[model samples]
Target: MSGIYIHIPFCKQACHYCDFHFSTSTKKKSQLVEMLCEELELRKDEIGRNIQTIYFGGGTPSLLNSEELDHIFKTIFEYFKVSETAEITLEANPDDLTEEVIKMLNASPINRLSIGVQSFFGKDLKLMNRAHNSEEALRSLQLAKHYFDNISIDLIYGIPGQSNEQWKRNLQQALELDIPHISSYALTVEPKTALEKFIEKGKVKPVEDEQYREQFDILVETLTSKGFEHYEFSNYGKPGYHSQNNMAYWLGKPYLGIGPSAHSFDGRSRKWNISNNSLYINSIQAGKLPQQTEELSTTDSYNEYVMTRLRTKFGVNLEEIQEKFGEKYKLHFLKEADRFLQDGLMDTSEETFHITPNGKFLSDGIAADLFYIDK
Candidate 1:
């Protein structure tokens, strides 16, 4: 099934670690939203299937008022063949999830909420420059659970000063709320971000490797014991609650990405829109698409399949690879995977090969090693 992803690239405030394309100013918010609706209409015929999921991601989708959201939804319904039970998700911040907002969202088409509750401690929140405090984080989830059953919360580990105890408290708090799904990640300092600058100037300690690994281990063990499926490397969900949009992506289904800086993937190629909001709006007004596209090579396709599938619980399907790509690719994969299997970094079922827990943290590197280099 196909999906649609709308990038709402406007945030209330910029977080210290965020490097995603977003504007802190709402000066062009109205125009951007209008352009987004236009983009959806422009690309309506791209995906020739019923859209099963609609994900509202980035900058902070929670910042959009009800009227803006309704207009966008109306446009989507008018232009796209959306499934009746589509999984419509909004990525929101805690501070924006006021009771009033939750009430409005409950009545809207959005069936899922991915709350960005980075940490539950004031010190961590301040360090990350999150807009919400520890109190707002809890209160938002408490109110959200009351309205939406399909909810996911984001948590971060490996903050420089976040101790094992603090990380445990964070997990315990999420579990106490009975959150069905969670997406957690290590706090990597990307270049040009405020966190990276802080580290370079010695204003903050860099993330320690040992602490990061320890907390990751704690995260895996703690969540798995509580019956959460470690489906993707950084995502865990209960049965019947896994993210449909993300799963469609991992499985390499086609999707249309609308709005500035959004990326789209058909079966054979990938494309991304221009990152500048003004440029995007201007181009749309000029009746032209502002995006770049790339056609995938066979080797490119093979490597991508390996990279995305290995991080998943289903792992790499050897038979499917052989059937779809060729025997040579599958043989090459088995040959290269020998060392990882021998070292217990990976394991193979009768039909699939997957990273073991010992290798999950290093999955990206491992996937790179197994990449299909055109020789």
Candidate 2:
């Protein structure tokens, strides 16, 4: 397996725009941790090779205590063959990254930290209902820098009222922190999210696509100009600092996901644990894994390949398409993509299809148009 992803499904508070599975009450935190360990042990036989990465994504993994973390680590070490130099990362929030927490993490097996500092501005933080204020976000990074070298921070752009100047300032602040990697994304209003209700109720202004595009352009220009590679659509990393766990997903490497709401993928199938924490914990305690599996069809794999590869620097290779999906699939891709190549939206010079600068903003639409769906 390329990596293992463990989801910590407890958050201090819900962000207005978030739709991910999580709970505000960490009442069952200890129980959940035990179940996660049990699930890990139960699925140990699935991985046939040494794991190269381990990522603790959240709800807010930083909420985990040292003892809790150690227990999980011990279980992992006992059950799996993890590489000595594995890129172990823990997703954190600024409020939880006190000096004590930072020092504790620094002494642990984890070598990387992905901090969720959605905004360095109080106005933006408040609007998004983020638990950390502007000062806390800045202070935590300063403290984290003293303990960690491989660090990434999450930033959200295109907040309804944020100006281009403010957006640029956010990038500049992160750059000043000497952050090696950044995962910046536009603030999207998902259905049933508070952000969506706010917009619909006129409590908040709707984010314009034009504004989002402008900020994205600003992000790409600013980060790349500072010697960071736009490795994936939303991820920018300095050389040798790209996220291994993230790359595993983008490159379609096999990974095992453990915990409520976590998703996993082998070469041919996908599985996702139940989203309900209580159901997940109960099922695991009863010696049953609460997950649903989907066996991917040829069209499913082809669509997935097109969707993910098109978003990264490693664009699709025609020969690779044919070898993996058959000649008809490759032909379909070319026939569907012929217009883009002719329009200069996609480059075909190297027998590899890459999105040109002019087409980056329309990447999702382009990828969708190329997907092979059965009639």
Worst 10 residues of 1 by lDDT: 41-50
Residue 54, model 2: Cα distance from true site in angstroms: 0.2
Residue pairs with colliding backbones in model 2 are none
Question: How much lDDT does candidate 2 score?
Answer: 0.94
lDDT of 1 by residue, 318-347 (tens): 888987789889999999999999999999
Worst 10 residues of 2 by lDDT: 41-50
lDDT of 2 by residue, 1-375 (tens): 578999999999999999999999999999999999999999987755579999999899999999999999999999888998899999999999999999999989999999999999999999999999999999999999999999999999999899999999999999999999999999998999999999999999998889999999999999999999998999999999999999999888999999999999988999999999999999999999999999999999999999999999999889989988999989999999999988988997678999988889899999999999899
Once model 2 is optimally superposed onto the true structure by TM-score, how far is the C-alpha of residue 123 displaced, in angstroms? 0.4
Candidate 2 to truth, TM: 0.99
